[model samples]
Target: MSTLGWWRLIYAAFAGFLLFHGFSASENAPNYSFMHNATSAPFLSYYDYIVVGGGTAGCPLAATLSHLANVLLLERGGSPYGDPNITKLVNFGASLSDLSPWSPSQRFISTDGVINSRARVLGGGSCLNAGFYTRASPEYIRQAGWDGRLVNQSYEWVEKLVAFEPHLGHWQSAVRNGLLEVGVVPFNGFTFDHINGTKVGGTIFDEQGNRHTAADLLEYANPRGLTVLLYATVQKILFRFRGRRSRPEAYGVIFRDGSGIEHRAYLKYGFKNEIIISAGALGSPQLLMLSGVGPVAHLKAHNIPVVLDQPLVGQGMCDNPMNAVFVPSPIPVEVSLIEVVGITHFGSYIEAASGETFSASVTTTSRNYGMFSPKIGQLSTVPPKQRTPEAIARAVEYLDNLDQAALQGGFILEKIMGPISTGHLELQTRNPDDNPSVTFNYFQHPLDLQRCVQGIQTIGKIVESESFSKFRYDYMSWPGLVNMTEHSPINLLPRHYNSSIPLETFCRDTVMTIWHYHGGCQVSRVVDPDYKVLGVEALRVIDGSTFNYSPGTNPQATVMMLGRYMGVKILRERLGN
Candidate 1:
């Protein structure tokens, strides 16, 4: 074998050993049989409450609700067990690029030309994301009108079981120092609160690099009361109208198992028994529309009979716009995901990750857009996973020449909070598995653009900080390597930009999603303060879909907390406490 081949072989062997040791044993949790595959499980006709989508919100919600009543949790995807791509933190980006029908993430492209993915596993995006965990800001809690004491208790419950204090690696520590050097504010040190300052946040990855997702919260469930069915694709909500002038009521749901078998689950005989849609932002709205609820014209176009002509079913969608600076290191950087964060007063959160490798083969299909990968010029223009063949080749060639050393880098990214810019979601096809057409009109609002500019400038300052100097290259002998000095003082430029493009234009063209998208069943618009769907009965969306704004630095913690919080509230009300 060649000399390069020998080095590659040795490196691979050593890396495998480290990874195996760092990611030991099955996930720690109660040995419960509540989880079952929908394909083989015996059918039940009635459940006190049916929670759809066993994700970040759905898992905790089902677990909490099961304490007092029989709860059936149906997830469209299989359980997130034993899959290295989903369970191991070292393989963070691999699952997102998996284009198989059963992959944990379902890739989609917005009509506005931005690429993104939706979670398909039991744990939802919590299984596919970088695992940063932070509580919602106190201000956010007050704005949402939540009981402060209950919110704190819920967050504590989730943190005890799943969230962990991350052990910062070399790359992460450096990033934190750089953030402080740039005047992000007084260091809050290690804390889960989302205050405006530099702090080391909590992570779902334990010390061994094993991911403890929201699915693990199932251990808290009343084993006899909760039944978890995986690979159960809910087709539509079965609705019935009591009288001609009465409001439509959700009674049951129709779903398909993995083997193409159909089944129906109904609410037990009681006004309190309910059907809850905890499916995510896209899934919840899409499911509602498919079940004959949404704008009348759109439903008519798809030939779905209108159960309710609610015009705002799939409107008011928002995504946090992310812009990043890839800093290629002069030395080896340890692999890490989001650990340290900088909450700025400018309404943007700064975060960093290192040593994440992208699978070139995964990028062959348009459905799988590679994450903040090297060589931006080739990837930014590539169409959706399978949209074009030539583009696929370009995507491949984009990273074909880079060696292992060149891939060793860290990304300093900034994502605007609130993102004032908003868009809407629409059904592309009636199939629930098909991705709904979404348009997150990024930077459409003037204030959003201004925030982007301010965030980008902050990132530039961090890049130029003395602490970050040791990690970056002042000059590179190789062509196309990022010269940190040349791009200083607004280093928002990716590989595609030179000196000609305006910063605002770069913000628009190079715009990407931080994977935080919410709304479409916003509070006071589609659902009431109690999260019950307005103009409907016994139906509620207790997921990110109901949120008007994304919470915290990342929304996973808040979503998980909401699940637990609502579960307690429902149980208390049911028991008349």
Candidate 2:
């Protein structure tokens, strides 16, 4: 079949990835009658399971565990229900720009000089991410020693309520074709299965452009068994030295509410009852270190009482390095998140997004805050609405200098798959809400750098494809005057990389994070295969921090599934199934 004709057939068959016929607007908010303010609630005592950090993995884990066990979920941030910036697709990237204490997204910069964000809301990163949903490759499932049947069932359990097929538009379609044109081969079309091909994956967003986060999966929970406390930050995991021969046991967590009033929640007296840390990559590790479960010397330096003295707690950190080529479009393009992807044979993946609202500001969540700065000078932590004059002037000047054409364009990005270069996290302070000091050491490994070079070249091929010409900007012409028929070749950002700079150097200098970071409390190192923290009883790390390698194009799907899968496994073990 002819290429164009074949693509038409593929599109017709897939219907542009809005593939599932599911429920409508009502699914956006699930009535959580059991949810309460950490401060307003009466003092709580114990739960069958105490799940810390009500995030992507934490939500599903808590919800599933609540089927038969009483679960207490503590989240440091507010709810995502009324946050339009998080729920609406048109306002997708806006949440990350908000630096206020109440913002759903908390921006963090790695000591490696890469800017990143952590989810502060109940839904976690899902509330701040591009909302793409794709399962881990089958190889990933096998390597993790996951029960295939249960794994598939767990993915479906989450998907049935949350995941949806995405609607493909002109830009996404062009990207789909461009991926095939560049020999990323085999038009697998619309699928949630992770495979080596160009395909449209699932999204958490439904047809109405409203995101369905892991928080929505709480609808499956038994409300009577689940108590979710919003705006509660867990200060530390309280441990007991049972005897000289026994390891320290995690019995409960000490958390502070929004009013800064301390509260204690403990685990029920049962062998199966546990305290699970579902904090993201950063949070999980930081929580562990703060609770005196990390490296002994480091914890001692911080004057924290040693609990486990586990050296691997904050080690093996990694973040996928992302680079992009912004293709300026002549006409108005539809705004979209990550809807289509090209999974290549090599250790890399290609994805694209159009019409993202780009903003510049210094995210002040870390001591290394100036690293991610776009030279806007110093800004106050008071947020934009109440910014000082000097800060306001700096932001205004930066915005005024932005090229109008750049805002009208789309970005075709490539991120190195499963970056081999690893770094470590250290506690900057004992404060639970403070950002942890981390370094991803992007492209530190020669193989990772080579993969990045290959990925960028693949993107270059996509840019040079005939399919992308329809949207390529006419660089020769002035801004807003680009003629669609006569366009210039799209290139990487000049300030980032060019013909003069070597690709390896470009990979190092322009490296940014796709936020697929994992490890720290890695499996086989800190946690067992069952995700239980080694040397510590009744305590586990169930989030992205436990991952050795990030699964699929986005780790969110696997992370969510892990929550459900592990919860089910724990329940079965309780039943002796």
Candidate 3:
């Protein structure tokens, strides 16, 4: 079926169901009143706590906080529950490639010429990403100074709602054995805990292939105390100035609703009433900077008024670098995402995606639209001051290349789990609707490049193993268009392994982001151990942005755990339990 046909069918199915049966009033059923368009509703006078960006952390945090106090949760995008494009596991790539302004996954290009997207939906990355889920390593919890017992409990709270063990198919099974052949030792079997070995961990997609995201955690929310506003774009955090030298205190938030109507949600009279910024790595920092809490120099450049002048808000951005080897199978493989992952000894991770490749029709349409034309201008939302035409061109070209490459079948992803290189995010324009200027600075350090090279080498070994040899005829030098001899003995290692320069060049050309961005609002720098932003009162940031370092795994689970941990901490502090 065509995309439009599929959408119409989905809409009809949902509408018919809703018409026949009214929404359920059970605790697990989402409250219809809570999920409303902000433009139509009366302005809320006050909320004991306001959580911005109803995403991975925001959803869970707001739900937890609502138990004790009146809470308002604001999300920029519409609900993810009924969106077939988001709830279906097969439409994962389509979710990210969606270019509509209201798309849950907002596509953007980094300053370093990488095309990527961040979740604008209620469930955040969990709604758009490759659905792989794993718990943070014990070392990660220790490193972050989290109470070991509390962290374990937090993981359980999140897992019980959104996570499930995946049933590995033929291709996934082959991947498992291949990893073992590559010496990624003792299989830990199916489990969620992050251990040093090959293992099949939990996935957000359930047995029926329906994706459960962080938004599902809101099922536990206290309906009487929780109010969720969709399409509520938070423009800035409102603060009350005391004196020239006195610290600024957060009082409320200034936001625009779906119809471009502005609304204010303020903190109630209690001293403990607070505002939490749960936007992801890029978003949290951008919101902070927009609220005048970033480096004074950057704010001045954008002509934004400074409030706190804290220099660390948007700094320390880091993302895992990923490279892939596409193997086009003549025989069809079962559709799957990351079911079995290889935690290699070389500080890298190996995962694979199997199913139909992205169609060639997409590339044809893109080319016809003159993507390469010199007249193709930069995105209008990108301000003239921050626009880099060359970078934009390079990013567009890379996307074109990637689309063309994806037309062929089988997919394997090799990622540098712990990269030494880092990047930063800054505002492009003062407009909250505009995307931030992101610089992942991928492979900037020599060690990062070497790690990627090692990862690719490991993947080559896995593919060459006897377990994967059955699909040998399916091998292609690259995706879509074949560059080398058909099915000739695959060897990326012999040529590139011994030579560093060629390997580096290959990595530079093919390396892309796995979308595991973290550490923009880093602990000890932007927020304290308690997750509160420095030099600010009644404000905290509790998302992936607050990660001290990358958790060295798929971060969706960790991000959810952080929300649970923060929620419990806030409750404990408030109730004096």
User: Highest lDDT among the candidates is held by which one?
Assistant: 1
lDDT of 1 by residue, 206-253 (tens): 999888899989989999999998778899998998898989889999
Q: What are the lDDT figures for the candidates, one per model?
A: 0.79, 0.78, 0.75
Residue 576, model 2: lDDT of: 85
Instruction: Kindly indicate the candidate among 2 and 3 with the higher TM-score.
Output: 2
C-alpha RMSD between model 1 and the true structure:
7.6
> Residues 71-140, candidate 2, lDDT per residue (tens digit)?
8999987777755667777665566666656667777777765657888888898887888999999999
Cα miss at 500, model 1 (Å)? 1.7
Instruction: Please list the residue runs of candidate 3 whose C-alpha ends up more than 4 Å from where it truly belongs after superposition.
Output: 1-33, 243-245, 357-409, 474-496, 499-501
What is the full ranking by lDDT, best candidate first? 1, 2, 3
TM-score of each: 0.89, 0.86, 0.85
RMSD of each: 7.6, 11.1, 6.9
- The sequence of per-residue lDDT tens digits that candidate 3 reaches over residues 1-577 is 5463355335434533542354432223354546666655466569999999899899888888889999999988767765666776655565565565666888777787666678888888888877889998988888889999988898899989999999998888888999998798879999898898899988999898778899899987888889888778899999886787778899999987765667888998996889999988888999999999999999999888898888878888887877766565545677788888888787888888776523232312343111111112222122223335564455446445544324223567678876788888889999887899988788899988888888888888887899887654543443433533322211123234656546666677655667787878989999899988899989999999987567747988988888888999999999983
Q: Which lDDT value does model 2 have at 483?
A: 31
Return whichever of 1 and 2 wins on lDDT: 1
Off by over 4 Å in 2: 1-28, 356-406, 474-498
